[model samples]
Target chain A: MQISASKWLDIWQANRRLTRRVIEAFPEDQLFSFSIGGMRTFGDMIKELLAVEGPGIEEIVTGVRQKFDEHASYQTKHELLDKWDAETARIDKFWADLPSEKYLERVNLFGQYESSVIDAILYFVENEIHHRGQGFVYLRSLGIQPPFFWER
Target chain B: MQISASKWLDIWQANRRLTRRVIEAFPEDQLFSFSIGGMRTFGDMIKELLAVEGPGIEEIVTGVRQKFDEHASYQTKHELLDKWDAETARIDKFWADLPSEKYLERVNLFGQYESSVIDAILYFVENEIHHRGQGFVYLRSLGIQPPFFWER
Candidate 1:
């Protein structure tokens, strides 16, 4: 059975809760430490998450692709949290207003001609988990236990 | 700068490597245990990853999502590896062919108005990391140390 838009919204809500909880687990001081080289620090990844989605959404609505600079200012945990709340709310509204039939419509995704609306939504949740996983590792490396595992 | 599609592909390749290596490090019998209730068993999570992405991609393409049965055919680590490899190959090919401009296009994602293709691609990579992080906790709960953190 194809997942309907409403189910996708529920998933998004669950994911938002998980992601926010994960981000909040770390002490603000360690957010930027290089627990490992090459991979982004936990804080950097959080910043990246905040920076990317809104601009990406803007690009889609306007049909214009814009360059995202890595060094753009996203300095504080509070800012990231605020942005996360705003972006998720915006996304939720977007999903709520979406028509169900478009879920099957193919769209170009980063040069690939494959995407159902639901797949994109699933990816949104999945991507956060991937990076936050790194954050979890960072916490462990510092000998700071992350929030209880199921707290997500 | 806007990330090239190849950047995402490269990241995904690296992510798969990291995730698999994590799995490989686990003792076979302990794969299903976790300290957190409702925390997906490591094996169960891996199966979910495999089961979801391919069929999810198929759903994205054809607009028909399938309900996944609780048990996947692969009970052994080797079987899971095989499925993971095969599915990775499939996704790589589909992604490699993606047209770069579509990254900015709006398209329906699970009945949502449409997210930028770039966000979708980012979501794919990020989602993997998110779950893989959970897998890491499961590893630690077993008192089993994981591989070198930066191998990816």
Candidate 2:
């Protein structure tokens, strides 16, 4: 394998850690309201990420498909962070349930995206990084310094 | 291998194609002058990408260290696109010279970042996606629709 399953997971977790820092850097008031160029707010983007990872892993572990949902409401930044923390643990559990061979299996992710398990996992991380990049701009525009991109 | 080296190269090329589309979506003048919230212009980001991939691959192929440079000035968007096209071809040639076994070897990329060749290559793609996400915001702010992220 070009990369072992564990190494790839480690990379994904590192990215997740960086993303969490981006989320924490946002001012609470701006978390949901701030946006540039009609883009979705960082808060909305985080919800989309929260919607995907844990449920996506669950779907991968079992044969059941998940409906993509990004409309969960977290009335406060604290609430959002709580959910984010919970989802991280849930993802670890679901990920541990995934067999090594399943990494190569083709499955329909969220009943929307179709690809090998590996590709789907890669997309999950890529999507977060893309959104996080936008978050970085949002932070910079607000005169705040974002966490270093390579620190992950 | 979880993914063959050729398949990984194909993925990188696909990302390059999508990034090229992002570059094409920008107005010539705005390509260098337009940015939101004090971020670097998408053109500058493109130059950084141009500085990395081809040279990074060459470094991996020959054990040569490259000095990271993003200071090349292109007077027009056409010139930048021309360089982008040339780099794509150069990256392919350099990539072909890289033996599959070398994917697992560690080296200092740009005489700065040290990691296995595969991780370094992944960083190249992730960095592009990161900047492209910002470009998407720049385009939307300009009332121009950027290319779809998943089309890559």
Candidate 3:
């Protein structure tokens, strides 16, 4: 069950690619405003997801902590997709220099979630799958078929 | 991040516990037939998830390949929960015996997906999270509040 930090970077990148496709599937109109029952819209979910990456990983790579923020960036679907792509490249740049053994060491994620870097890393992928699931629901409700999960 | 094979077992088990709570949130009558739109009912999604573990991990451990089967088990929520609990324990029993190094080696999952055993193991959790996201939508549409994502 051990994953090298490089392999984890690959895994994270793959999932992020799939998530980008999920964002693409959204009708721009419903991306942020539609909600099932009282649940938050896909936009809000996406924002929360975007917020988790850059700062969280930065904190791990550097010992500096940061507060989680989802509301400050990207108010539109186009902007979110751009931000997602940029974040993808950001990880590509930072992930390579990250030592695999560092994943085994503890990192205080966002100064709130305190756990091993591996656990925090897993949380990134886990959170995406969860949010994408919500997006799938949103798409189906709007009569759109999301990109197939296996395509990733 | 390096997760010993045993620690992966713990991580998987913790996530399973949360998923079980999600199953518990479903109204007995709606667990099987509920859908957000044209999406498969949460029950069918659950069955696909149930099919992945047990036999999948067993194949990794015993080197005896088992075909994927999602339709052959469970006709009711009662049976499903029982199966889920049993599978949880089954993982506990077998997961420890799995060599941590095996996770670094590749295994063709259910004769289709091929990757390192660690990737396949992560898929088990990722797939469940995806389906559970659908379950969340189903619950919300039915006027039920689903379990919180972070509870895991």
Q: What DockQ results do all the predictions give, each relative to the true complex? A: 0.15, 0.71, 0.76
Query: Candidate 3, residues A47-129: lDDT per residue as tens digits?
Result: 88878987778778877877799885567889999988888887787776677758778887876788888788778888888
Candidate 1's residue-wise lDDT over A1-152, tens digit each?
23345655665566667778767776777666654534566777777666555544444344455455445566667876887898788776655556665554554543432455444444556566666675666666666666653343
Assess each prediction's global lDDT (C-alpha) against the native: 0.62, 0.88, 0.82
Of 1 and 3, the candidate ranking higher by lDDT:
3
The residue-by-residue lDDT of candidate 1 on B29-128, one tens digit each, is 8776543444457888788777656544444444454554437867788888888899788777667555665555554554542455554554555556
lDDT string, candidate 3, B1-152, tens digits: 65666677777888888888888898888887777768887778878888898888888888888889998557688888998998887787778678775767889878887987877888888888888888888888888887888887
Q: Please identify model 2 stretches exceeding 4 Å from their true place.
A: none
DockQ for candidate 2, please give it. 0.71
* Selected candidate, larger TM-score, 1 vs 2: 2
List the candidates ranked by TM-score, beginning with the highest. Answer: 2, 3, 1
Specify the highest-DockQ model's number: 3
lDDT of 2 by residue, B1-152 (tens): 27877788888999999999999999999999998777789999999999999889988998878778997898688998899999999899998888888878989888788898888898999999999999988898899988888997
Number of clashes in every candidate structure? 17, 2, 0
